[model samples]
Target: MAHCKTSLAAFIFSSSTDQWLAAPSKDLSGLALDKHDLEEMSVAQHYIPKRHYAYGCFYWDWVQFGIKKLLLLDTTNMEFSTADLPPGEWSKQGIAIVEAGEGRLGMFGFHSETSSDLSYTVARNKGESPSQWQMEKTMSLDSGYKYCIRDATQRYFLFTRVEASTSLENRLVVGYFSMDIKTLQLQRVYEKQYYSQYQSYTYINFPPSLLSSRRI
Candidate 1:
């Protein structure tokens, strides 16, 4: 990624050379990019840290001059590109990039600050023409408690539920849950017995051997 005030550039770490090498630039003639559009482009500021990997590509959320775009890093060719965010009112609060089945990119987010419904949209024909977003599904969460999206990856997103409190500092996280993007299933991964402030959650992958039981 490029540093502040520098021309946009991407580099890949070479395991063989043990050094960072410039990534090969791909022909972006098909995209709507121009020199002016990229003049102030950067990945450092207003960048969403939650990265989603799908179909040999990594996706991130980037906001340039109040316009939101998805920064795409194609690992297959070690190239970088950008895509426009899906149309409509999308809040940055809980937005997440996820892998839609059949080698497609999908995004999940709430419609509004007070809405209890979470919407999922998938990008169709990405990189061919201006990508089209199709609404796949909408799931409603429990309206009794307030919820916050903490992190997301693959086909799952981690969220926290807290009792509504007027003061941010006084808010207490009541539970942590994981929502399956495909099935829209909500599963409680953890419940807090004592009061605590909101915190980040991470997904951990355990080997099959550790998850399975074997007779000694």
Candidate 2:
């Protein structure tokens, strides 16, 4: 796998092996607001660049990018397209949401890279289709990267590296731009992780081969 910004939480599941992708986000619009929704209301574009590809499995291959909307690749022709979760009205980036047993939809979790900070805004999921993008709230970082992951109940487990010494290594930094749902305030959450390795060349799996090997 490549250096992925996160796991397959946002990816849509597909059995085609060739062309499949998924992106999970808060289903707000008074329908199903997830965890990220608690922080923002307006929607804006949040680009998931190619620098954070990390360990991924299952639906991971379908993720082309996470921009103003979630993008997936059409493995049959190596083309990219949209995912099943329609981008909210005026949404920027998508946040994968899961409904907890407590009857609340919230963000499962997300991972970011060193190049950019993860931020979110809210928007309406109204109109005719799910592709309608929207924006609601924008804010700055609140909790550090250590708060990215947590249990289903929202309890968190954070692990980060303090930059005490300078070394020839690349580190993963988690930055969050907080947005208040009610007031539309924004804050930032910044933290870092280290990977003391470097890469000079990159290789992506051939879509054709990736398809043929599938049990389909």
Candidate 3:
């Protein structure tokens, strides 16, 4: 397993050696990133807590001081790199990285508070051409309620709907739902009329066999 810090230093734990080893710095020249943008790079902050893993790499949504990009750590080579977000207005909204199956990376973006469509895009790389993002699917959501993406994993995303209000503190969470990335199925996980001071929520899905089996 590898861990990264703000300084871009990576440390890996080797089970065979039973020790933590520091990974060497990686060159970003081959990544095709602008020199100026590389200088301003920053890792994900506390507000963005979710980390995505796919294609032998771990990804984190990084945005700091107007610099927005995906910080990638390739576990196979123990190197760190960055990938630009998908183009368009959706990139400015709340987005989460997801595995799109078959060694592809997918992203889910909320289409503002008024829009009912949630945009899903996947990265496409063909031949020697640069990788680009292409729209895959747009899942329609209830426009009546305001939704906020809380967390995302391999194939499931956790989101909450809160009562629309001018003040953030006065807003009340009314519904919580988890959406399956593959099936595009929305499952209501929790619903209640309550005020929550917590800023984050985590959704855990257990396999059906485990849920039905008797506890020892």
Candidate 4:
């Protein structure tokens, strides 16, 4: 899967095996959003394995792109659609997608302020109907200054936190935490602290097939 930025073109490569193909590019004339809107912002897409679908977030912010809306792909029907995010003040850093309880896809967004609870918009079931999307749950991540959810499940969730600092430093007082993925209650069970420095950070969870299969 790749995005064509030169033109209003995006692509999906379908093959039985992990074979390469030279797919011809074409403008996204009518798919997803309008052509004019597509030209305005680049799409940052992520594949949700549990749902067998993917979504694209429009790039609007520099440090954290695509904070406003998202474009969704229905793999079962091979159709493109747009969906509105949950109502709340969201940060690019705190915004993420996780597998909520019952293997439902959940849109995780946090409040701008640290004192508030993290918002979660989950789909009612494993279907494409937008009406099924509802406010599933919310939880707190106030253990540290700032936090981001990396992955989640019905039993547990993984996240990282960056502590407050006085001066501009290249390093971050980082902490890794995992807690019971309960409804409105996160019972902490694992945690660790360390200092990490990187040019950029990307949170991703690879498929088990790719992780354990023969290395490419």
Candidate 5:
């Protein structure tokens, strides 16, 4: 873990860790994926949401939860909630999310390896699932850098990195998908002109636009 001059901290681990931690900063704006020892940091409230179950019912049981309250100085009127998964509540083997259509909260999760298991969920507010969590119409990458999903101007983007075999290869995968915001239908918008295997691609987004595409 290293903290920059801006006090923004970044944690990098082994190769395996790099594969999973390729997600960008914006996706982590109001949320944290809580693990046992280490977790993502929030520049705002130092808020951390963990997966915990009380009694038979689960409370705050989310693999990753969004930050509902962002009180700068005063932590009063604190609102807390959890984003629920789909109706069947399929455990997200791999998950990613971004802001939905500007203000709504939208997320996509990969269930095992089956395209039929791929699902999407949107929330009006924090921690609240829409009436239904729908399965994506398309399939996700089978392997490589885990797919990170984001929305831009009513279109969804999927990012991943393809690694080259030798030392001379550049480390970036040049592929992106554009999708409809409502139905989760996707079409390939950007693709690699030349086949150069990349180590990994990191995804980050601005409120309304994609900020950077980095190969690290």
Candidate 6:
């Protein structure tokens, strides 16, 4: 597994060892899928390192025409597969997946009308019905702000607010915060202090990844 390239890389993770290893080569089809195919990954865009409760990792497929799909990669056995998305949840433009709590996969989504308020859901890979998602929580932030991680035990997000006016236009404040999603409680985490008034701020959650680019 030694074929590595700047444009492409593959990482192997072992839950038992609790460590990460980069594939010696990225060209092995059985070991890794071509990175080009990731362009079609769903709204979550990139895989964020969270809890791995099973033998593989899960991903969202890009909305095609009007359909979106879930994909899972088994690093343990070197296999790839897809799962069905919870009904109507995929079409929601504002959707996020995160480590909800208790080692379960959590999903957050919003209706077409409100981008700031998101409904929470968790994926059950085992128990009575595996691979099923159940709703847990929902929240709506004040105007000009949005959530970064939805339904997580500790949720973090960014927001923008009209703070003042300069010359003939208004000024805004871009800020970040974390909260207890279940309790609807929040605390200011960070504030940008300065930003473009007319432009909207885009929030991207950059948690550490399940894999590393460096070789073992």
Tens digit per residue, CA lDDT, model 4, 1-216: 345553322345557766654434434454455544554444533322112222322211211443344545544444445554555566655455555655565665665635446676887775433345687666655654666555544345555666645233644646555555345455443354544544323334557865764211
Return the lDDT, model 3, position 91: 30
RMSD of 6: 9.7
Q: Alpha-carbon error at 70 in model 1, in Å? A: 0.8
* Cα lDDT, all candidates: 0.65, 0.29, 0.65, 0.49, 0.38, 0.45
Query: Model 1: how far is 25 from its true place, Å?
Result: 8.5
Backbone clash pairs for candidate 6 read: 1-24, 1-25, 2-24, 2-25, 3-25
- What would the per-residue lDDT of candidate 2 be over residues 29-124, giving only the tens digit for each residue? 332334453233223223323221111111111122322333333333333233234232221222432222232222212233321233332223
The lDDT of model 6 is: 0.45
The list of candidate 2 runs beyond 4 A from truth reads 1-118, 126-129, 142-216
Worst 10 residues of 5 by lDDT: 69-78
Each prediction's TM-score versus the true structure: 0.74, 0.26, 0.74, 0.59, 0.36, 0.48
Q: What does candidate 4 score in Cα RMSD to the true structure? A: 6.6
Return the lDDT, model 6, position 216. Answer: 11
- Candidate 5 lDDT, 1-216, residue by residue in tens: 222222222233558645533212223323333432123233422443322221111222233332222111111222222344554433323344544553445555554422333456565454233334444344545454434332333244454323323223444544666555566676665666344433334343444444355311
Error of 6 at 3 (Å): 16
* TM-score of decoy 1: 0.74
93-200 in candidate 1: lDDT tens per residue? 567777777767777787666666788888886541127889988888887667667777676888777776535667677888888878888899888744555346
Each prediction's total of clashing residue pairs, residues at least 3 apart in sequence or on different chains, is 0, 57, 0, 1, 6, 5
**lDDT minimum window of 10 residues, candidate 4:** 54-63
